[model samples]
Target: MILTYAKTLMFLLMSYAMAETEVGENDLNEVSDQVYGVKINKCCELNEIMVDSVCRLAELLNQSMWEPQFKTEDGIAAALKYFNYVTGVPDCATTQQRPIFDLGKSEDELNLLTDGRLQHLIHHLHSSDQIKDDPLITNTYSIHEAIAIPEVKEPSSYIHDQAKYCMDKIIITSSNITGQYALVCVPEVIINWKETSFLMKKILNPLFHAIAMVLYLLVAIIYFVIPTLRDLAGNIITTINICLIVSQAADLVRIFTELSNHVSFMVTDIILYISLLGAFFWLNSFGFYIWKTFKSRNVFLRVTDVRKYCYYSSVVWFAVGVMAAMAICAHFLLDSGSNPYKKMRLSNTIILEDIEQETIGWLGIAVFFTPVAFTIIFNLFFYVTTLKVIKRINIYGRIHYKLKGCFDLFLQIFLIMTTAWLFLLLSWLNFDGLFYAHIVVNLLQAILIFYVCVVRQSHVTFLLRKSCCYAEPIPTGEWGDEMTHMNGGNY
Candidate 1:
């Protein structure tokens, strides 16, 4: 009786172990199905689907109490152990075969069949050609045979082929799984090329602009200290540089702070528009100054009226400010949501749409871009007229033998205006190559100003050299008079 009772207990334990193994197999199948569904629904690439499915299955195993007797610390290790046990094969770490199913074989036979290789299968169930030709063998054989069979033609090809039928099967199963939890377990999606391009622009814009600001600030200080550099044109250039610096600085701040608050966003927007308007006005001023200097043949304006220039510039600045303000107000009024200026974050792509639909948006865009466009056109006209006037004066011998100098002046004005216009043009076109070119040219604005206003002007260069060499400072009036005469009264 004692021996019989002991035997009965042993039999019961064996039955329980078998039952647990079967339950573990069922659990793994369910997990695999969920992972396959996630892959299909997301429409992942071939290799991505494999990696994602494996990772997802591991995640599911970790979350559930599947195979409690396996005694592994985490899901990935548990999965690896489970694969080893089911295949009756040791350390199948790199094997690509389907998950193990019951084969009604002894451990020795199973080991022989798998060649003791532990398989971690990523089956491309969509490839119909990989299935066996015999209907009975195809329907009854393990899914692992598609990958494991030595006779299978091009295993890699089979793995890469789209899993259409499997995808459909998984999709059908997904509807019953609440919340589709397997998706959460997959690895984070990799950023595509489009997102990478935007990210690069975001990072580089602020960094390059900040460097430009420092250069501009240094040039501004030089203008203040060097007496010969202090002139109407110099002052205008300095102001333009300052405005650009402010605008770019505000943009940098907005990028970092994410334009989180309405007040911050509005302040940044207003400052940006105002500064941009100022830059356009300054460019126009420079163009007009060149035209006026060449046409009237005087370094100083013949009328000696600076107030008119100031008035015109102020009108432009204020008009743009008001328009920008109205646009902001309209955005708030029309959006009726948490973040009105959220669209502005992707301003290049969506600003046109805003202008078409929103009243103030159109007005604001018109006020800003219209002035810029007109400035380019007017500058071109001024440049051509100035060139004609200079040529006529040279032929008549009214201006001294400085035809080369006059030509250089024309070239400088043309280049400055053209470069500025190109930036706006490229921005509007939104081509990757053109956009990057715009950034390069835009950042060089300060250096260009320094070179044109300080380095190129003989009087300023003389003063800069003298100051650097610790020589006595030249009288401002003497240098100014000399430069006036050198340009034939057209500095």
Candidate 2:
């Protein structure tokens, strides 16, 4: 559904170019400005028509949803209106004609687009690369650039609002400086991701709650989840450190807004990418750890070494750690000023998209499959080595329940959401399509995080809290007391 709309938008944009050439009665107009008077008069007429149409559509869409209106629908409809306007659909005053008024000399004829005007403006901008990319018109970059330009002298003000409030301030101050060829994206990706995450989280709670109860019961037997005993802690810590670095890289964005230098922002992007490499390693580590716990026969999850992969399966974490002791000796110092976004295909580190992104995507699939392979291997061992052990062992019952508790399909939603985000990021990096995928993933990730967080709180929280707590240490591989009791079917 979404891709179809995108192609249709692209086709319409190309059609507009052809339409502009043929629309003149003599078929000889060289520029949009060659035909004028109707620009002002028709712009007004189209504005009025669209506002009226949207107000009516608003009422209809609201009625269909059975309420005054939904915030989500309103946002989508508004965006759709802007998209429609940017493309300059037929009969829009914008399509018929548009006026470029001089701010210094002419009366301000640019009426801020209301819903009706939105359709005309967005359609024009969407189809006309000239309109959308022009910094003076509606480009996303112009705003990004403006945000980098600073007015407030206070340091705290810069850090707090950079992501949210700062962008708006920059736009208002930017006025006419926004150049053409700047709008990088529209919010198509932003809307869809938000909805699906909400839907998944809503459905996963009951099983999670049941699982958590089982985990709390198992706490008397298991000392801890196996992943935390060794390298996994370091991996999680590394993930956190990279996040801190990314937060630090964020300073360059502020510097850009303050000085209006695009270079600083570019540097910041470099740092972000470098940091993401670290982040991805830890995330993969955590994902694999969780996979192990869910599938392990002993009900204790152990972290496996990811080394010995076919290719760049992430070797940097260990190499970097080995060199960390040299930091005090002037080796491997922090490159606070260094741009991490600088793309490189280092021989050792596995990049997801090393001209071989498609090949690496398979590794992600393999990362997913490692547990399935482990499950088969372990289940067979459990049958041969531990099946009779269970008959004699009461604690063995806890093992069965907690193992089931740890791995739920409910948990996969987070992995799925992250995978989608990763694909979107890779695609954007490759410049396949923009706006649609990123926006969807960003919005989806947010919703997924919230849903997953809540589900974790309600269901898995018990498992995590029980494991992390200092209540007491217990035996490693036996069936938990709770599991043994539950074997009596008490649960």
Candidate 3:
């Protein structure tokens, strides 16, 4: 009886244990099903959110382009928020809230948004036929690219950085999903109202500069070869041409190479200043010489010594050099860990900085351009005085001679210096006319110099006439007082 009872007890214990095991297995299966269902639902919800976010972004971008008063920063911020929410990344606002212009806030915002995944999203959006076809979408995308994209050394590395950086920003939750990635790019923007004028300037400025440089070089070479061409005017013109050539050559280098260092920035800055200051100085010298020539006509009756010319030239060069040096020194002293010349790229056939801060802010402007401003004022005064003298002489006698001289002088002033002043004014006012005027006038500076000093000169005409067998050798005496004054006199 005792053995039978023990067997029954053992059998009951085994049966109960087996039943508990079955129940536990069933509970586990049910829990797994619930978990899987939750995952699918969450993923579906995320998909819906992403789709909605994308559509909203597209709408915001379109609105930004269409609405003239739309704040681009606000639009970008809103788009970024939506993008973050959909991508399982925290919104920039939640992470750090501040104004758009706040440097630290801006940097943080950019870091949060610029992950590889966002870049991938941008690439996909940009490549869509619908987005490409829509002008509003295209322009908005361009603005984002300009403001958001970071420079990377390698294309593949950009992708890797994007992925790694984005992952760092995100928490590795069980529900998260990884996606394919690609790079993004933005096209430059153009306003429809000013498109024609801007485009013309963009195309013509470089073309004209190249043509002018070649012409100046050829003319300078000719002046060097011909003994008769060697004079005070010729020497000044040659120096001006050399400065211009160096400046233009630097400009070309900027177009080809990305100048990211302080040395290149300083060199480019110096070269540009020298070109501009040198040209204005020489123009002023011409005006001064003309005024002096007319004033001393009867009293002095002779050209100023070449030594005086050299002295004047040295003074101008030294002054410009000082200004350039000051600008460089200021940049070094007031660096503030933010350089004005950084991440420069070739754009519209010119080297342009992606971000341009004043060299030392306002101080830089004051130091660099004060002398140029004074020079411009003095040149203008000289020009007016010379014109008045020419008019006075014409009233007394030599009407034809005075008229020819006045016309030549007028052309010289207009081409060399007047246009540059006009550019400054128009640029300050942000006038649309500046686009065409600046390109045409500034790029053709060398050509204008050539015309004033060589093509219009009587000596050149006589030489050309003789060489071409178009006329016999005219006696130097019969060439008129204008030619004699221009050749023998310093004016």
Candidate 4:
């Protein structure tokens, strides 16, 4: 009952105050005409004076009803000051031999009366505060007086289209560089609680990438420590591990940098792309090595040719580096002719474009993807050839169980990579649902490799036993060609 009474009392007080302080249309019209010599009872002619009249009327309304206190003289001066600052009115240009104001039809031609200029001129009015040392408008009545105005209860509609145009133009213009460049042109993408993919991108993706980096490092260390593990397969796996580490490190750096520094961010991105492409090329080497082994019909011999592997690695690395450099150059130089808003350089004015967006150009997307596409194609070809050779081996003499295990490991790695790439393609096509899956598959690759190549093998335990002097020494013939083909054999 007490709360209801308080509400009723407040409503009555507000109504009384509004009725006392309300400024009628006649008063505003009088002020407008007095200032601009144009009546505001109806829309006037579309000319300079009419525009000034509308702007002056808006300023009067804003000062009387929205401000802390009504000041007709001050409002008139402020409006005139703003108009002069923006339009340079009453000042004749020597070149044109007339007023500096150009009432041009095109937005570009009317440079002085642009929306950007108007917004900038009146940006200070966005804030409302008590007058620190004022005789008329004190702290107590300042807040209440503005609210008590009738316009606060019901919005004041403009009867004239010109007046509406005046308010509309000023209200929509941005007050800051971020608003003009980032917020205004781009369509906002709101990620709510339901958007699990965005959350995964923010948190889970980095966590998994870190975990995978550690796992890859551990596997690489294991391969290096175990002398018997340093075979053809070991060298290739170590290269793959290094590539994964570089790629993950680059990605993690890129994620945390907030994209504030353009040069460092671009460099990280370049490293990431090159490392990823290199890893896939190494995967292609997997099928190539396996297919070569089977086709030679030398099942008993392990091809641990260091020189051959070095040559292949050098070629792959050099090719990947060249392609990446070319792609980066092409991306910046070529123009895709996409939507101007989509492109980084929205205008010739460099201040208006986002730094990150400007650095990452759109045209070289296909050029960069070209190497990935080629690697995937070759990966498929090598896998198919390896599978055919495997079928032939199965039909004839029985293959060693250890060799088949190595092949299975290779196949798992290949599938993981291919599936991750496919998911990336889908996500690129705007399949938002697959975004989390893409991140998970791409980031957890090293974890799977560590599990299969290190944890699943008895090599680490065998080495530990040997170091502690608690295991029987291996027979001389046992560490022969067959053992080399095992990759990581059970002790």
Candidate 5:
């Protein structure tokens, strides 16, 4: 709505306070070739000049119909602004570009746009408050609009400030980054909710699959695998680690064990599609540390630094878990819906997808680099310290003070874990799924830890065993016997 037509439609709508006609659909086609030029009229009775002809003249003569325009972040933003304005709804959050934009193709090109055109469209959005603002047209994620978000858990009333849903939801079952750089993002996205329900009736959630009480007891005892070392292995590093591993493993087994019943669930084959660069770095360093330890023979790890790493990783991981748990709790407790309990069951994975997509490159850089900068500084201090200790204390010293292997082993794990964190950065870049990337690295970490504890330890133990074996044979003949003979000769 423009002020130049103020005497006409403006008076009708405002003074009359309720008139609704402005550029009727019937007249839209015939109304104008007059956007920027002189025009003849189909409505000949009214044509002194349609007067709105030429943008400049219309503005100059107090007869403007259209507002000015400018660019926003993307062309989609511009489209969203105009559409939301027209439709009276909010904007949509978009997906992470899968580098698909880099390819050359026709549809791939920016939609038949002239340079600097969107800039013109966006300028108008800021200038006028009186014009009808469309929700679809300007999806500036200002936390106020009412477009549907993934869960629709928070029902914000403003159409423009609402949230959008993730097309595919996956609840990350495990975010383990301890062992082999492994993490698993388990999909709890329930696109196939009906099928899941039907199957649950038959299989009964696997843990409680048996219907009869006796059968339930028997089944639970038998298949439940009752938490053991065999179940945990060296892979479960902490309580958090154990919980994550079991939960994800159970989730996977539940889905698969009840495959026919829950067949409709659309799960990502994360193992296949995802890359584990984190695990790669962890393993690469694991091998390096092992080679150094075995060849140098005097290497050992310190326990203090191990405690420190464990403490911090646990704290950070715990906080992340708590935040996630609280969010789920809040959604369930706060929703005014009649069945919040039922809704909490899914705990939607689609939210992660939306987050993964919406986060831009700059944020990605910050997330990756912040930990990275800290890790580098930490590692530099330890590395220089280690070298200083070596030069000063001297491993080859005759006293044979015993804590050497322990110290080196501790340092080995420290260097491996700290240096390997960058694996996550590279992993995020390569694999879109963070959970799976963690799994890959964590698995490698397991392999490394085992190799360090077993293989490296075995070599040291083997050396000790040999030394023990030679104790009897080497004693007098080597040094003591020679000294005795010399004394005899001297006497």
Candidate 6:
């Protein structure tokens, strides 16, 4: 939906320029003289609009309002209006038709116009090849030039707000037309929006999430279908898959909601928070179970599987609930106006600064990563402890094939999930280069789980009978069998 609207806006801009050419009308010199105090008869033609002037009006000056409006539809709509006015959208009074003084006379109208003007302005600059990578100038170089220009000094106060605060810069060369140095402006939200949309938001996100949901359902069905496979490990894996399904579903829903511009921010965020955190806790439980199994001298310390599952469920769900509650409280307590998912990602790592708390960055880290950090640390400990226990057992006798297999499966899951999340954290930390890696790894999670649990499991092979001939029964025991000799039958 965004892409289509953008294309239509560009078409209208070009059509307007073409129509002006037919009528032999020129507003460039007038706009440049009035807005930037520069006299120019001609400049680089972009829909008959000067690139340098647009840079100043769209980006350099719009920095103050960009943060508060960029995440919401009101800001996006306001941006289109401002762009139409500046670009001479049809019926919008131009300097030729009406006095320049008539242009933003009312404070309230200017306030409304200023909210989202940056979005469309950045779009035009990018389309004109004036921002991202131009042969004559770059965004960083443009900022320095803009700072030096006398005309830009009046609005220089907002220049300090850079990419970290969700803004980008574009270099504007004006020497050829104005007999003066070039100017610049940085673009943040719009550029990031396009890049993220292409990478995962608009296309890849829904595709991967849909595929993952299907895979999760398939694996779950197989787990429930095969009676012998419904052991403790199977139950844990099944629960994790279910949580993942929920997470993916929520993500898909969010993508649509954002595109339609009717977002229920609080509801979607809560669902995502609970489901994603729930998946992590369930994964942590898998690690914990393995470590406890190795450390125990007897099978599950003689505890029934039902009771054990109940205990695990309680702990995992409670942790998820606690994280959700903390996030909800932070939303209301810290900055009610802030939308942490501004960057179109799940984590609330990026947000505008609030006067009292400095910014919601601290709140995001505290509410989200604090529990995640602890979970990752504990999972690592469990993995290490399990390995040590295996080494000690190896010193005495060979480990059981089933136990070893379980360890391998759990380790694969742990590594995949850990690596994906680590890259996700790095991406959120402004590691622009690692975003592609993060996307690839994150999308492969469901595939990895299916491969490890369904395709490679001996019990699965036994149930499917794809590997053996004549449906002959394989002698592989169930995962819940007591390893009496290995650890005194306390499995």
Q: On residues 1-491, what C-alpha lDDT tens digit does candidate 4 reach at each position?
A: 99999999999999987876665655776676556542111122222122222333444334221111111322232222211111222111111111011111101111112111211111112123322122222211122222223333332111111111111121111211000100111112233534454467657878888888998898877666566666667677788888888988997875542333223655676787788888888877866777676677566654466786887788888888887878787765554343211112111222112222223344555566677788778767776777776676644432345455557667887777777667766765545467667777766666677877777666555665665576555322334324533444546
Each model's lDDT:
0.46, 0.31, 0.45, 0.50, 0.30, 0.51
TM-score order of candidates, top first? 4, 6, 3, 1, 2, 5
Which candidate achieves the best lDDT against the true structure? 6
User: Worst lDDT window (10 residues) for model 1?
Assistant: 106-115
In the order shown, what is each candidate's alpha-carbon RMSD? 16.9, 24.7, 16.3, 18.1, 23.5, 18.1
Model 5 CA lDDT for position 282: 29
Query: Candidate 3's error at 471, in angstroms?
Result: 13
Weakest lDDT window of 10 consecutive positions for candidate 2: 161-170
- Locate the minimum summed-lDDT window of 10 residues in model 3: 96-105
lDDT of each residue in 1-491, candidate 5, tens digit only:
56668778766668554333344543553443223222111111121112211112233434323221323435443321221112111122222111101011101111211222111011111212211132211221211111134444432211111121101101111221111000112223334344534344223333331222232232223212222111111122232223323333333432342232232221212221111212222222323333343345453333123453455445545544443444334434443222111011222322211211121223322432344355456545545654555556544522112234434554565555554455644644533355344444544544554455435653333433434665532212222122222333421
Q: What's model 3's lDDT at 314?
A: 86
For each candidate in turn, the TM-score is 0.48, 0.28, 0.52, 0.54, 0.27, 0.53
lDDT tens digits, residue span 433-463, model 6 = 6765665666788888888888876557545
Q: Which residue segments of model 6 deviate by more than 4 Å?
A: 1-200, 257-261, 300-304, 335-365, 394-401, 429-433, 466-491
Estimate, for each residue in 460-489, the C-alpha lDDT of model 1 and write its tens digit: 566666678768765554333235435534
Q: Which ten residues in a row have the lowest lDDT in candidate 6?
A: 94-103
Candidate 6: how many backbone clashes?
Answer: 15
Candidate 2, backbone clash total: 49
What is the lDDT, from 0 to 100, of the residue 101 in candidate 4? 12
Model 4 misplaced stretches (Cα beyond 4 Å):
1-198, 257-259, 299-302, 336-356, 359-363, 394-403, 458-491
Give candidate 3 misplaced runs (Cα > 4 Å).
1-204, 256-263, 297-305, 334-339, 342-362, 394-407, 424-437, 465-491
TM-score between candidate 6 and the true structure? 0.53
Please provide the root mean square deviation of candidate 5 (C-alpha atoms, Å): 23.5
Highest TM-score scorer: 4
